[model samples]
Target: MAKKNSATKLFVLDTNVLMHDPSSIFRFEEHDIYLPMVTLEELDNNKKGVSEVARNARQTSRNLEEIIGTNEESLEKGRSLGIKGNTHVTGKLFLQTTALPHDLPMLAGSKADNQILGIVSYLKNIHPDRQVILVSKDINIRIKARALGIAAEDYFNDKVLEDTEMLYTGITELPEDFWEKHSKDMESWQENGRMFYRLTGPMCPNFSVNEFIFYEFDKPFHAIVRKISGKTATLEIIKDFINGKHNIWGINARNREQNFALNLLMDPDIDFVTLLGQAGTGKTLLTLAAGLAQTLDKKIYNEIIMTRVTVPVGEDIGFLPGTEEEKMTPWMGALEDNLDVLNKTDEEAGEWGRAATQDLIRSR
Candidate 1:
């Protein structure tokens, strides 16, 4: 054990933390990091596969090698993590060169986890004046560490927001008196058959471009911010995809959220769009409908390629026997189901016509 300053805390990183985010080592600015030998062993064991975890493990090994360099003496004394370009990382990285003994009880499973816990316990004993915390992604490991009175915390650098409620939903609801507050100097016009409004008020500065805003009061208003400059924002009336006449490839938006999503998806100016919702929220269905409309009807896109990560929920089904498309067929059951629904939207198209349309959609 080595003596440390009271201001600098020592963070003992678990194998899962490194596997989750390789750059986590550099993220703890001005705080020292200690890596147990068991953690290194686990990283080595996980570095063989082509999965993201394996790739991150390999990258962590590379980062360690870069930090450790060719100085064997520094390995025992701890290496300064303040590399030339990364001035923010002003702490040293300590690797377990020699094992520290602990009197903790033996755990039944996961020897690596137990060994890491033991190392944290030993470090806490030696560095009583300094804070020694265990950073792990596994909840069970955190619980075990806490049960033993060892300070434990989840690696939070990878989290985009501490509270998910603070996340941007890409939509905002206007107050009931929105018109009365902002309609004083509001300017209105039309461009390309789309209605546009320029408004300046206390709320104008808070509005972000492309963020949907709606009012469901006496007169429903749904629009998207097109431009924002100074204290003024230009809002364009979004297409009413919920109306049957404005359906996208035989699919109409079922609700206000879906209408906003379709407005973004169907827009030609927006190059990228992301949809986040629960399983039955029509994300896939709406996306497929918009893609089909653009690719097949509008002829703006040459093809629609649909693919998703083929992660099985349960036991592995073993190697699937087929070409690339055939292997992916099982994973695309949702896509197939959505296409069936889209194909049936045309009542005028007979069964044979629907089947032919489905074939065309699949081919593209």
Candidate 2:
């Protein structure tokens, strides 16, 4: 391939970039697509996996196969008609593939990433005029690309906010008046402050009885929202879990932290919650109370699995071991302490402690 002026650009795609987002190829409608022979090999290896990205990659490869076939010369001349002329399967639409330049760089000794950068270096040497832009989602790939004097960028198709960790906007504490006026329907609260910016339709949907809404203006309080509540509940409600007496000496779930707690607690998909806390953060009590209300009172799930990781202080408690149940006793003993407080606090709460505890473990 002959090197031309910097009038046109050649795009070198990293395998991860393609995998990260399959729409990558279609996104760059104005550039010639270049995938190193090694990248094709990598993609072939990735295709055997059962991931959605693999399937999408396989489909994209098949489409490209029909367009470019195996003709190196046709690709070289930019004569291979594809979904478009501006888009080439082998990067030669604009002085596409060049000969390997100097040997690959000596970074990270023998990483696959380094080998990929080596290929990029060779392509850049052959087509120095056309901008050899390496597109990859891997930070290391872009780092190596730039280190070797090749222009590199993240795959624009790369994503964020796909999982629970990302979309969690945490909790939002509205003033009492705003919350009372808080309608799940955005149209009802159009004049309200920026709280509606994060939400698309309604703030909290009707399907949130198991979920929560915390209120903390001058004081901190919580409400548990029942999504898809049954006939027993006369009120369309999300009750708060707050008892000033029950407050841990130093426990604070305020503002965004409060929001995150509710976000995780009220999350419909997450049936279990485990809060790890130090001395005073009402962790143990809040857990027991919320759990009992949901399992028995509110009737969300059939049982509440309340247990904790017990790192024994020092010497081992002498053996009284039998089955796994007996073996768990030493560890389970500490969790019982919290339940004792809960049971002692509410006299009418029934014989829930041991019964719920046993049923919870047995159900598991």
Candidate 3:
């Protein structure tokens, strides 16, 4: 594989890339941008709908107009993308005004994908001294670009994390001897049934409110940072959800992380909570159990409103004939499966009783 140069390179933007983020052109910083005429046509065609893609298309058109309007440079010679407000852009933007010297295997119809690929090939050929790459959000276009010997990349400007592993877990594991070193000016107190501790240390500044931190000693001590004042941080010790007395829906937390999660989930004071975990980590099970216990048993809230991204795991089931809840049933198999486990916790609630409980929970 050829190493990518740190020098300013030319990036050819696909219509989808611009629609994904209107500011993507400026996001390149010092790099130049090339927009194919076909890309502009596609953007114009898509700029007339009410959907999110349409709105993004319109925004991209407006941004392009602003950039072009601010620059007085000729179209053929290229124009500076930077305007008065955004003087950080040091690269120029060019539009494809002339025909390219290439031809692809003829297809049945006039496809936009082929036109974009041809433009990338043309840019790479003309700019032999510099690297010319195609940037798009479409997987198929990127694959086709690579097949045609053009360097292609995804539009990473709008991505939350460059790598999935870099996502914040909300839990920070402190060193085993963390408490020993940081406990010098520690202050402890019990407030309204909850325990709080204040410790001053260099690590205090890195802490954020509602962030879980734990120290591993003979036993794990887990707490959530409730407040931070300069070098001092007040951490509230997470409740022991594993204790038999505090079990929710007959489920005991299996680990420190689970216990901490249960603490957040069951807390009435915490208006909203987000749980993140990989598959088989009991994320859904814990959340469902806590929601049921609070809404059904404790009567803390009127009802539980559960919804999730309807991303299909396998082949989609196409259209289903049912009401809203029924249509959403296929997407909620995990939730239903967890409820079944919770319903079976009470052995006294035999087959018929379990069915009744399941039905009642489902009705909610």
Candidate 4:
């Protein structure tokens, strides 16, 4: 860590730090906020990117320009200068010089990043008494800065928290006369919304089904009940793909996340679904089987829309690739193999489940 810059630290805000959290300069509160000139130049250059992140950066820059213009003078006094939420700006807290080479590449060999580094190096060398901190949201930039002997750190306030965790017990066993030993407690168990069980680590359950009871492990890992039979089932996960069922495998659906992906696929309001999943998980097999059941047999969707990433793992499709589709064909060839896995051999002879998936997509 660089020496702390009194209450008014001189912070060189990297382009990425601003993009990650537009309000960062204001966050330091009445500090010497330094915006690298190159950072602004690069943001202006990225105004045309169609990504959400790019749009946000452009918007934030425009907003900042308005603030800097409004408080052009007071910012130099090192006092509160801008909007209420924003800390007072201090005039151009940093000076400019073409100290860095302009010949560096824009991205692959970014001149902006190198220039920001140069500015920090300049400040550190000339103003040894002042705390010169380079704030960047890019992990790689921070690493590169450290490698070049610049004091760099990540802007952590904008980061999101990860979800909490819960432990899983794969197996639970009850003695042969299970109810007899616990009968006295069974009546009050369901009544008081409590289910308690004794844990013995001697046994473990393998490839399981309903027998592996699910419970809320927060209290005791044994207090809750798996209600598939009579109690309330907290949550049920359909593990195996039904023989001819649609969407049984590769559940890349987003419901389990934010009720996002799968719901989008199933909603009549949505007309398109693009799923990406890994191998041996029935990504293709599940859909094809469903299509057969819903479509040709009983009209559902007009047709199925499918696509492949095209590039195989490790090898680049662009370099080794023959024709675009030809290169991608082998990847989808797995879909053909999955179709064979479905009982599609006698398609016209009987009720095929292929229509189920096709019709399902259309209905959604």
Top candidate (TM-score): 1
Off by over 4 Å in 4: 1-33, 44-60, 66-69, 76-115, 122-144, 153-278, 287-304, 307-331, 344-364
| Candidates 2 and 4 compared by lDDT, better number | 2
What CA RMSD would you report for each candidate? 3.7, 10.4, 4.8, 10.9
Global lDDT scores for all candidate models = 0.88, 0.56, 0.84, 0.52
**Roughly what TM-score does model 2 have, to 2 decimal places?**
0.45
Task: For candidate 1, report its TM-score.
Answer: 0.82
Tens digits of per-residue lDDT, candidate 4, 197-228, equal 43322222231322343233333222222233
Model 3 lDDT at residue 26: 88
Q: How far out, in Å, is residue 90 in model 2?
A: 16
* lDDT by residue (tens digit), candidate 1, 213-245: 999999999999999988899999999998999
Poorest lDDT segment (10 consecutive residues) of candidate 4? 200-209
Tens-place lDDT per residue, model 2, 164-215, is: 5454332345456543544333231223221211122234443244434455
Model 3's TM-score against the true structure = 0.79
**Inter-residue clash pairs, candidate 1:** none
Candidate 3: what lDDT? 0.84
Model 1: CA > 4 A from native: 1-8, 37-58, 68-90, 96-115, 137-143, 156-164, 313-316, 322-325
